[model samples]
Target: MEDIAEAAAYGVAAPSAASSGAVRRPAAAPVAAGAPPGMAAAPAAPAPPMAGGLAAAAPPSAPRTAPPAEAAPVMGGVLQKEALGLVEIVPFRGVRRTMARHMAESVAKQAQVTTMDEADVTIIKRIREKERTVAAERGVRLTYLAFAIKACTAALKRFPRLNAVLKESGEEFVLKRYYNIGIAIDTKSGLVVPNIKAADTKSIFEIAAEIVDLVDRAEQRHLGVDELHGGTFTITNYGAIGGVYATPVINYPEVAILGMGRVRELPVVHEGKVLTRLLLPLSLTFDHQLIDGAEAARFLNLVMSYLEDPDLLLLEGA
Candidate 1:
């Protein structure tokens, strides 16, 4: 089973006959003459209407069409829509069987636990409170997830290797260049991770808006293939459902997954005196294959620092 699982991970075999049977290659469209390789032909234009007996005279300044000899060369390339239709699928061979067995044995598997310090998100809550009205005017809801996503983006920028994939072929891991942050949404059917592409470039409001739309589509099970691919890092807010300090399973392929637990009032020492503060539990599960415990702690610390004083994040963006 272990060998089969490893083989499946490397795309060596299908997970099962049923899973393998689901793989299908999309059909390609015809190419046109003079079109670039892989490019489809442009659609033909409609013919001009026939002249009538009382047709209006042409304008004096009307420009004449240039002859083909003087026409600029047409730059042709395959349309992404057409290319997407030609995607090839490799059947999952080994992982499906192991995945099924793991699902059944999940309760019995000993969880690898690691507890990080709680983050005081009072400032984050305050910012959301202050921006809720303005955000609504912009047609985007201000949520903690937006702030979390921003923090993750900034942290990943500082620590690029954290955004990597683990492969057994080499001792080294592959670090991803683009930042596509995936947010895990729980649906009635199962879990889904819809990614926000080029997340580092979006504003906090934009991130919040996209997150809301993604979650809505996920719940409705209307997400497309593009929304569910190319995740360099993942954030799962299990806290939304009232879970506290859970060791979440790593979303395979991505090196790190950040989990947020419920926020609650807790006593903490500040300015030499104990004070009650609203704190959030954050759990970061990282692939040991890509990052060590120390680096993971630092990444989590960076996120915690931003949450503690979200004003810093706002100023950084400014």
Candidate 2:
């Protein structure tokens, strides 16, 4: 009857003919803006029936809500099927394979411990600026890395434990008498570590020139096996690539590796005055089995001392 039809028009349960009572549908609450997550607005109700049995026009529907922010990036990997399927298989080859094996072996063999520190190198930077033209005259490109190499060699000589290697038999360790400092370089093939023979005896300018030659030869894959092996200590300058700090892995067999980060100028309290200074970040990763944390810290401090005062480097024959 009319009452039942009226109830049905509003999507409410119709009353039986025996009851014939009008049933009412409650209006759903409007969804508030910026509702908590996992909530959605209710749909608009259908229009009521008119007197002539024609239904009235329905009210406008609520706007569809956007999906949650967390669920919308690339549609939860539903749009990114490339990862789910076999995209391409490129196995390591040649130098890449060698690098992979060596890196894995180094990680498996050594118990690595990393320590971080920053050094004020404002004076060193100023010295480099003044000596840049002199270095250019000698066909040597002056760089912070050259200074770091000099500092590291001095530190290694001072803290010989850091420049030592643990024996494979686990009975004793060897402290190298000569300094063959490895300089890690990135080539097209992979990472190449070519060491400078007797790095401790070389002057800053000589080391800089050797670094250039080693890098050029390394990239060309023309370095001898002697250059690759016999590295008593290693240094990697990730600062060249803009890395601030990193827990660098040790070049296996060598007890420690020094990682240099980018130099950033920041305000510091020096001599009761707030002044900006160039600060270099350093990371030292060492084999814990061979070198203790305290020993590593002292070694890093010595390196920083030479860098902070370029005078120390000159006094040390750098």
| Local accuracy of candidate 2 as per-residue lDDT tens digits, 1-318 | 442232222212212212122322343344555666435555646778999999998767569664433222221122122546423223344454565677788999999999999999999888888988999998898788888888998888889998888999889999999899899899776676889999888888999999999998876667776787899889999999889999988888898999999999999999999999999999999999988899999999999999999898777665
TM-score of each: 0.64, 0.73
Number of the top candidate by lDDT? Answer: 2
Tens digits of per-residue lDDT for model 1 on 116-228? 66789877787788888999998888877888898889888778877987665646678888899999887653456779999989988999999989988766656766676
Worst ten in a row by lDDT for model 2: 11-20
Off by over 4 Å in 1: 1-115
> Residue 100 CA error for candidate 2 (Å)?
1.3
Off by over 4 Å in 2: 1-83, 316-318
Give the whole-model CA lDDT for all candidates, comma-separated: 0.71, 0.79
